[model samples]
Target: MRNHLVPVTAAALVAVSSFAFAATQHHATGSVKTYDSKAMTLSLDDGSTYTLPKSFKDPGLKTGEKVNVAWQQSGTMKMVDKVTIQK
Candidate 1:
């Protein structure tokens, strides 16, 4: 039973680690369509929206601002790791 359990545990660990590695950061550039401070979300012109993590500082962004965003996806939720507003 212990032998069987070892493989199962190892497989589970590998699966979890693979999932973590797969959630690497990605970049997007677009004009902001909307920014909801209350909801902590920003929508881009390319139709991609990101949820800002609470730990992330406000970039003083506004609707229609062009931006470059670094984000990560965990399941269905998209979280912004960093954002840069374009001039």
Candidate 2:
């Protein structure tokens, strides 16, 4: 019984880890509509908005600037992982 329980627990852990790793990462390209430095949020022309992590720094982002954003969903928020200003 103990041996069976151990295998079952290990399998459950593996399933949970796989699900966590399978969270989709997304990418988008659009012109910036707004950037709130204080709020750490960015809105794009495509009607998508993202919340930047606190550790993220502005890369001279401004309204109407073209950018490519890489992000992933974290609970109810879309968290920005990377941002690149498009020339």
Candidate 3:
């Protein structure tokens, strides 16, 4: 009886942990499509568009720049976290 109870508890814990892990939350990636001295427009690979704030996009990005961007709600909104320029 004790052995059976322990196994059940462990299984419950495992299931809860899996659920928690899935709720960690994450953002999608985006890329730089156009840039200028003040701002830039980023296009996500998921076919979404986002505008980078002037404070962040100032001096703009180059063409074909890949950036680490986070998206909200099916890639509607995006914010660039990191930019990696490709040759």
Ranking by lDDT: 2, 1, 3
TM-score of each: 0.73, 0.78, 0.36
Residue 27 of model 2, lDDT score: 94
Model 3, clash count?
A: 0
The digit string of per-residue lDDT tens for model 2 on 7-73 reads 9999999999989886878999999999998999999998988999999989999899999999998
Stretch of 10 with least lDDT, candidate 1: 54-63
Query: Once model 2 is optimally superposed onto the true structure by TM-score, how far is the C-alpha of residue 30 displaced, in angstroms?
Result: 0.5
Q: Single out the weakest 10-residue window by summed lDDT for candidate 3.
A: 70-79
For model 3, residues 18-79, the per-residue Cα lDDT tens digits are: 87774443455456655544445566455666655555634345556565554233245454
User: Which candidate do you rate higher for TM-score, 1 or 3?
Assistant: 1
Q: lDDT tens digits, residues 1-87, model 1?
A: 988999999999999999889879999999999988889998999898899988777778888888999999877988899999888
Most accurate candidate by lDDT: 2
Number of clashing pairs, model 1?
0
